[model samples]
Target chain A: MKNVQRIWTQGVALFGLSIIVGIAYNTTRIVSVPWIAQPIQLVNEMDRILKPVYEPSIKNISIDIAKQLVDKNIPFIDARDDEYYHEGHIPHAHSSGDLIKLTEYLDIAVGLFNPFVVYCSDDDCGSSEELAYQLQSEGFMNIYVFKGGWKEWNASGLPIEITSNE
Target chain B: MNKYIQLGIRLIVGGLFIYASIDKIVDPSEFAKQINNYHIIPFGLENAIALILPWLELFTGIGLIMGIYLEGSTIWIFLLLISFIALMGQAILRGYNIECGCGLKEGQMIGLAKIFENVIMLIALYWVIIQPKKYFIIFPKTELEE
Candidate 1:
């Protein structure tokens, strides 16, 4: 019957459309940049929205920080887990990850108002910078992140203080 | 029965598909992750599924809205609905916690409620398809008295 033929044609058409739509949508994403993942940025201006939040800046410190630390006896904190800190960490550094508890450890290690530097696993890890931000939020005026973190320190053969808090 | 209602439903459903596809087309990575999380498709097919499906939605949607190919577009919409339902049902049965990816963005959980909603909509569409007499479209059956 004519109706049966029409049904068959419609079914075939629908099947074809499904395939076409599926392919087109996927291709659009493959060509897009990573910025697409951050949808919130689209709704608000990045700088204005992010400025008040704790962030790291270039002037946080330079290489001479080591001499400064030795001279002023500045405190160093490791942001990785206890295992990484035990395996190796900056000499005289303590391990801390939760930003809320940085001050407790700081109090035990170097007392309030002492300059502090925090470092984490690697460049890809944002934990160090995040911890630094939390410190700033808590009114710890002189906080910095050793951006190179543990990987950079170990890779460059820097002197490490070994501890066995195991 | 009036003929306008059937045409109106088709246009509304088709337009919805086109509008929905736009956001996904703009960002496929988010949608791709959603598709993978459903666990209905293998990881390898995620990219392919993400690539071109939106265009099909847009095209079919527009075609239906325009009333240029009502019969063809209705069929396409039905098939799409069935596949979506199947995919959702399978995912639920398998106990996958995932965003359906039917709507915009990733990490938005779509559960059995959405699947059920689609089923009802598909049924309505099927009713319209079978008996278009209650609706109106640009094209109507007529004769010159041949």
Candidate 2:
């Protein structure tokens, strides 16, 4: 019994010592500032980790296909929410959301599909990519991602179609 | 079986912990994703956990390797393992598709395989605690002359 107790005491001491040392190491912290130091480090690291392979750029079509009111010829797909779409969209741009539910409007869009263009809020936004990928999976070809998207179009001071679905 | 074998295990496990912590400290956002996916903790605590966990791993690893505090280090490792087992169990229950975060980037989803691995390691750790002669000791060994 005494031997067992002695062993137990030793175990307790070892456990306590380990925690103290462990705590000591963790308490050491150095100020590594962002932008000045870490950002450069991360960019260099990201360059290595992000794959080199490239997917073909999705094409951008610049034409007004609705009743020929505007003199542009391209298929525009809107990748924004219903709220944004009802507020305004590039004329003749189809919503991917309604397409998912209806599935019938897909043919009308496909019928006019030459230089298909997908656009969303802006370049940094991912909705356009998601819609394009979904469309591609559904066998629609000639897809393009409008890097400029809505912000660019509005910023360019081009004509826009606005509605009050609200 | 012997002191050398125990030391070898300690070195390997400890070294891996230190190596794992380095990457996590460098890229915390990714580590935060791993912790969040487990869903054992809420979103509010995720960032704090992401910041603190790597440090815990680092200290535990360094302490074990240094062997200056074998008993403390071994127990900490044991407790860490227990916490890990619980976390993995929770992850598995919640249907998370994440690596076990065992410092391996190729961390596979927590599954029966991982549970088995943890169980085996826990047993080995228990043995180390019970039989201190098998592990590296901070105390200098008295030389025996025949």
Candidate 3:
């Protein structure tokens, strides 16, 4: 019993020390994160763009929203690697794997005014978000990130097309 | 032979923990995102955990290696390994298909292999706990008894 108490005490002390050191070291870092994360607010209006302020233009949307966009024939961008895209992808989705190449394709095939959805492997994959951000920086607007991505879409038995190996 | 074995366990576990902490300490935000991928932590508490966890790993690892607060470090190591196994197991069961956030390897997905690794470490820790004679301890357990 006494040994347990002593171990517990030491554990607490170690935790406290870690907290102190962590906070102090974080303060010294130039790219320190907030102690508490703030919720991401969706920006919908173009009026906010006029203020010369930069907010993330890409908004995360659920599978339902993605489906609605697909119904309306909004363009879909597959952000996975070329091989995965070749294996299978959402119907009529465009992908080149290379961001610059994809951007060029988007410019030639679909104008910037058209709203599009971007997706990767699944909710756990970060490539879709990353691609969306890159697209945003490249002056693309009205972008939506399909967070559920290909895994969810495929599991749901949605329409998908495979590129033929010629 | 027993003393040498104990020392080996300490070095392996301590070195592993310290190595695992470096990447997390360097990129707390990325670590937070990886933790969030598990979808277990609620109310965005992953940030707070991300901030503190690496430091704890570092300190406890140093303590284990140097034989400072040996019992406390071992206990913490046990708890951490259990937590890791549980988290990885749940992620696999739920089909989350996320990165392990282990800090040891980048893009290492959650799967049976990770859980197995943690179980091995847990077994090592058990040996440490049961060993009668602790070797090369800078601060002996007797001091805490007093």
Return the top candidate by lDDT: 3
| Candidate 1 stretches greater than 4 Å from native | A1-166, B104-107, B132-146
| TM-score of candidate 2 relative to the true fold | 0.47
lDDT of 3 by residue, B97-146 (tens): 55688999876878898999999999989988887667676775564321
For model 2 chain A, the run of ten residues with the poorest summed lDDT: A35-44
Task: Give DockQ per model, in order.
Answer: 0.13, 0.06, 0.44
Q: Over the stretch B12-76, how does candidate 1's per-residue lDDT look in tens digits?
A: 78877888788777766555656655544543566556655666677668767765455666777
- Lowest-lDDT window of 10 residues in candidate 3 chain A? A45-54
Which of candidates 1 and 3 reaches a greater DockQ?
3
Better model by lDDT: candidate 2 vs candidate 3 = 3
lDDT scores of the candidates, listed in order: 0.61, 0.58, 0.80
Candidate order by lDDT, highest to lowest?
3, 1, 2
For candidate 3, the clash count comes to: 0
Output the chain A TM-score of model 1: 0.56
Candidate 3 wrongly placed segments (more than 4 Å) = A42-58, A62-89, A94-116, A120-143, A148-166, B140-146
True contacts kept of each: 0.27, 0.05, 0.53
lDDT of 1 at A154: 76
Q: Residue A131 error for model 2, in Å?
A: 16
Q: Once superposed on the true structure, which residue ranges of model 2 sit more than 4 Å away at CA?
A: A1-166, B132-135, B139-146
RMSD of each: 13.5, 14.7, 4.9
